[model samples]
Target: MNGEGKVVCVTGASGYIASWIVKLLLLRGYTVNATVRDPNDKKKTDHLLALEGAKERLKLFKANLLEEGSFEHAIDGCDAVFHTASPVTLTVVADPQAELIDPAVKGTINILKTCTKVSFVKRVIVTSSISTVMFPRSPLGPTDLVDETTFSDPSLCEEKKLWYVLSKTLAEDAAWRFANANEIDLIVMNPGLVIGPILQPTLNFSVDVIVNFINGKNFFNRRYHRFVDVRDVALAHIKALETPSANGRYIIEGPIVTTNDVEKVLREFFPDLCNDDKREDIDMITKTYKLSVEKVKSLGIEFTPTETSLRDTVLSLKEKCLI
Candidate 1:
């Protein structure tokens, strides 16, 4: 087994993407130290404990991203760390620093600080979002592809009150600064809007978007949506750890699509669930952008078909009785 006798820590283990990573890690025979806010909460963690290798290899630890040493116990002695714990909010709040920035920047720094303290910790993988790399900017040329080289302007995010984007950008920036200064092997995975199956019961931001569409509660405006399977994002984390040559950031994404594109997929595959009434006023636009996957594809990561991902997501929602 690739993960035989290896151990790793996955922060925010109960999240939409992290849960999948933990499961994949366990199946590969790695001892997993998973961090969540409340390890004792069954609603948040029961699904994790029910996984194939949970009994023998998985251990849940309560940790908070805001606290400085919260992650020390969880990350200590692990071979690598996946820092997926961070605040995510799209709406405006009274305090951006308290609610968004502190947990992200300080939390990321805390994880790296622990990694530096532990002699056995070799690599650190941070689950950053595509929002960090791309943002609402002036249109690029048709041939221009947004790649790893481009980063969302923090000032712009702050000015426009894109709290989520600001948090991610600052956190990833902090991670890089810490990693480089301390000479830690850091691989950052920037995934597009991740959707697929959910291991945890609660709905995540992205999954909620799918559910809203299914329920036909239309609040979405015309925007280019980039997507990637949660499963692929999970495997990519493991692959980044296993692949010795893997370094820097990798953008795991698919073709840029629109809400209309996704709606068409849903209405075609899930005819019964499509609510046409709410979508009547949706602005159908052809706006789209290009995201280069050359870096991630270099790691031999092939994306799941967008339609398959959407269909599987809806199926998972049905299986879980979320919709």
Candidate 2:
């Protein structure tokens, strides 16, 4: 469907990746109904309002992932819904199902259900993670390149230990099941570690990782990076929505680099932040893993190079005074 004049609802509109998606959608002349947990949070909404054409076309709605029908109002009369609201945290929670899995799965079901109720809704694009398709399973062959077809085996998820991975896997599976049973046009975009500069420095999660690294918080001094820029991932979502021929899953993979590679880039770009005298206590693991992007490429999208992505991320951090 053409997004020229269509109204689209983007959940987690204040987030790192979702905010970019909202900005791009507004720039493309699409009306955006951006959902946030709290509409009163001026700090977040103000940045979105400041985006080009956002004030004219963007609408903010308060919604919760666990609350039933919370998204219905935001999605009402909308042509498409971009479900990017899901819990992403490093700390393991007590109840993975409640904190992570339930929200991811239930929120998807809620959004799709709302779409089914609205006849004008033709597409539902979900923001899934590469973790759903990539790690957790031992590589079958020497080539670790995973694709849309690759799914993380739940058997590999030890109870609630690797709860984040399990949550994504279960949530995505639930989405597919609901889509197939309801016969809805469902497309999922699985992005790797998302890193980039943010429209608002306060809303930058990807930048936090870079900042932590610069501050020597990465305990092992280890480098094992697999990431994609938030901008590219946002563009992929827009493409998935506009490209009617696009269906099923797409793996959005960026160039694979290690922590050392990130450090090297920092040293070149922000020498002030790089301490050569500091001992490298971190371990660097350069394991080969490829995420097949042929499907997304077929939809006429190209990803930025790993070096460029890293530089952009570093530059963004520097701009925000994070590094």
Candidate 3:
């Protein structure tokens, strides 16, 4: 497919990862038709508008996750569509299903329906979470290798109250079903907890985990988290778009860092701000889980170092006064 002057659409254009994908696409000379819930909201669209080459190549459209046919206009004339819109909140809301399920599963199907109508679309990349593959109820040991074939049992997710995990698993399942039924090319990316610098003013859910750690909250539940820089995830999307042989699902985890590893980085970055008194007593033997990177690595994607990713993320938080 031609990259020059190609039109591409991205849902949730204002989101953390989606914003980076848009930045990369615009830099690569692709005309981006980006969708947000409200195009009139200056806070969401401002960063996107200021992106390089956005003046001539970017177009913003208002689209709702629950609204059918809302994303039709945005993705209609595109060669590829990146569906990155999903609820990232981890807290147990009053209406967990509505807050997580409907928007993720139903919204994915809505985009696929629109893409089916748009004849120009050659590829559809859906942003699924690593939660879809990892068994949150029983995390794997350090040596365990999680790949595309592994899936979080949906029943297990429901029984274990893993709403966010359930949302992604269901959404990706529905997308694959729709793609198969319509004979469309679909590639799903299950990225582990995404980290890195902020292109937006507010903090995302993934970054908020780090913030919460600094706040000395939820330490009793401390465990290892696999992080993939958002920029690398965006590049993987581009790689999948370009690789004709790429199919099925791909795990996008970069490095696995334990909670103690995280605290060490925090202390190193901000000694004064991080209160030792408030810090949680990290376990001597932290349980760690790992994701297999063989699939995405086959496409030649290199990830940012764990230490560098953490340092830059904290520095960026400090720069934005979020720390």
Question: Estimated TM-score per prediction?
Answer: 0.93, 0.90, 0.92
List residue ranges in candidate 2 displaced over 4 A.
Answer: 136-141, 219-221, 272-286
The CA lDDT of each predicted structure is 0.86, 0.80, 0.85
lDDT tens per residue, model 1, 160-270: 888989999999998998889999999999997789999888788888878877777544554456679999999999999999999999998877676677888888656
Cα lDDT of model 2 by residue, 1-323, tens digit: 24577899999998889989998998889999999998888977888988998878899999998888888889998988999999887564888778888888888888888888878888899999887886556654546656788898877865436788888888899999999999989999998778777776583555677767666555334446666878889999999987879999998877667666777776677576653324553322224555578898887778777677778887776786665
TM-score pick, better of 1 and 3: 1
Residues 123-147, candidate 3, lDDT per residue (tens digit)?
9999998888877446567777678
Better of 2 and 3 by lDDT: 3
Clashes of each: 0, 5, 0
| Residue 175 C-alpha lDDT in model 3 | 91
Give the backbone clash total of model 1.
0
**Candidate 1: regions farther than 4 A off:** 136-139, 268-288
Candidate 1 structure, TM-score to reference = 0.93
